[model samples]
Target: MNSEIFSREIIVPQSAIDARGHVNNLVYLEWCLEVAEAHWETKANTDLKKKFAWYVLHHSIDYKASVFEGEQLKVETWIANYKGAKCERLYKIIRLTDQKIIIEAKTDWCLVNANTLRPSKITEEISTLFV
Candidate 1:
């Protein structure tokens, strides 16, 4: 994999917030999924339409600011590295209200065979495009 930025606009909702009155940690991950899926389907147009499956192997996040509901934000993600069948991606959540960074995350994902559920390589068509 390689580092290339992809951006998506997001609208935060009440459900995305925690009792502390800010966006929850897990909700940032949900944004990652939303933006990443769009990046894959609309931009890359890869194996997502077929019956391929992607599973998160690991995730790490660092919170820098309090993000509240009803806010417009931009999420940026990019491939950071890869090995075998695993790809590492980095994410940044920036609040448009103030251009302040609210969160950052790193995710490790692996493609799995839809039928066998065993690890599988991302199709060459997909991998080649990330390079």
Candidate 2:
């Protein structure tokens, strides 16, 4: 269990842009989920995955700038904090060309039992893996 920030670079595809000529607002939400899943998959082992699952409870995003197709962006995510059954995950999307922040977001996730799909308390062992 390591506290490390996970990052991935992505190019804005044509399909991601809306009629307004910039990346769609919904696309940003999609990116948040994409980065979060990638980060979790990299850290959670097979046994952990089988035992626990995460469900998003809430999300907040701040759009700083608009992005267009072909633009390269870096998406970064990390587990910010956790208590009891819930934890917060943070995200940042930065445009590569000018180093502008495109969007910043926070998502609240609840740990749950894989089979029962019920809320599970995040014990010390599980908390250590993220925080």
Candidate 3:
């Protein structure tokens, strides 16, 4: 698979903001999942989806700046590496108004059998899409 970066635009809503008047920590995590799922949906085919699924193994995030309500942000994600059943993904959340990077994150995901929920090897066809 080729190393391709996927991106999406997101708006910070009132519900996403915490008492601190900025986006909550958990909201950033949710955004990470959102972009990841969008990327997978665009790349994975029907047969691939039926054969395997991805489970988040770990997530590491750094909050560089606070995002306020009604702000527009650009979320970019890309696959960093893949081995066996596991792959690493990297993300950047940038504020559109000022072009500031508000968050930097990485998530580790494992391929698993869709039906049994057991870890499964990454097939050559699937790997090609991300390389």
Candidate 4:
């Protein structure tokens, strides 16, 4: 398995909160996606996949603590592993104050030929970059 850690700051907006008044558990996944997208754009230097062109095959997450509205959070993600068409990424949300872990997440994605809409072998550039 290979991994890359990425860091970015995010604000927990009011709309991101649940009825319980903290961040909606599901919103954490959005955080991971944002971080991963930036990492990919930086490494791949492209966003042709940005629209609806590229998609995630799977997403997994674990919320460790409540992330409240107005809090500044750190989103950290890694390209954890890949095999054939599948690539797995992991994420963690940290509170800046005490460095507390707010969440853990993982996502699996596939690189596809935009025109064909079928899974394509990860490009050698990506494989080498991830390595």
Candidate 5:
């Protein structure tokens, strides 16, 4: 386990399952956003969050295995890199029962001014949290 990673636990809900009887593709992305939001809220200060906000620029997910309803999952995420106003966040969704990786994903996020919604630099205060 990486010391820099932030982790969260989730349960597969029946509503998240598709007609194919497995978690839907979109649901995986939702989980990624959920965990990321949780991480930010927990780690970032109110003043920083009030000054800047993040917007997703891109998301890439590789489905390695299927997850079903009632299954427990561990979502581990960390900042892979940051440049200018953008950062790449990495994620791994593991099925706790067998300890298998169900999904591997990365999302590109850009920092933006909370009020103006324009691209903003990654400030030291924000960067230190991920580091």
Candidate 6:
């Protein structure tokens, strides 16, 4: 596992399927957040978590292909870049069975003071953890 890139595998769930028999678009967004949160929580120390939090500023996703229930997927994420209080994280959801990228996305996030809930500059300490 590359320290900079976080990945996890999951089977498409029935609840994520829509009437079209494919995973709903919104579910992709959910997966993005889930993976990002897991990466942060796993890497950050207790004091880091208590001092800082992240909030999504924007999400941009591309649906490359549809996936059905029970299809296995490999979700991967990495920080692309950071500036001031914000950073962009990139995602790729791949169909593991076929090795095809089903979804591609990027999310802009803002770092905030956990107590004040106001934007805070992303220091080298915080940015280096993900990059």
lDDT of 2 by residue, 1-131 (tens): 34568899999999999999999999999999998998778777899899999999999999999999999999988888888899888999999989999999999999999999999998887776655
Show how many residue pairs clash in every candidate, following the order shown.
0, 0, 4, 0, 0, 0
Per-candidate TM equals 0.85, 0.94, 0.95, 0.87, 0.96, 0.96
Question: Which of the numbered candidates is closest to the native, going by highest lDDT?
Answer: 6
The superposed Cα distance between candidate 6 and the true structure at residue 121, in angstroms, equals 0.8
CA lDDT of 68 in candidate 6?
97
- Over 4 Å off, model 4: 47-53
lDDT per residue as tens, model 3, 4-73: 8899998898999899899999999999999999899899999888888999999999999998999999
What lDDT tens digits, residue by residue, belong to model 5 across residues 1-131?
A: 12289999988989999999999999999999999988999998889889989999999999999999999999989998888899899999999999999999999999999999999998777888976
Residue-level lDDT for 120 in candidate 4: 75
Error of model 6, residue 66, in angstroms: 0.4
lDDT of 4 by residue, 59-110 (tens): 8787788978899999998777777777888888999988999888888898
- Summarize candidate 1's per-residue lDDT along 1-131 as a digit string, tens digits: 45579898888889998989988888888898888777667655544546566679998999998888899999998888776778888899999979999889988999777677788886676666555
| lDDT (10s digit) by residue, model 6, range 1-131 | 12388999999999999999999999999999999999999889999999999999999999999999999999999998888999889999999988999999999999999999999998988877875
* Worst 10 contiguous positions by lDDT, candidate 5: 1-10
Candidate 1 collision pairs: none
lDDT agreement of model 6 with the native: 0.93
How well does candidate 2 match the true structure, expressed as C-alpha RMSD?
A: 1.8
Flag regions of model 6 displaced more than 4 Å.
1-3
> What local distance difference test score does each model get?
0.81, 0.90, 0.92, 0.79, 0.92, 0.93
- Estimate the overall C-alpha local distance difference test score of candidate 3: 0.92
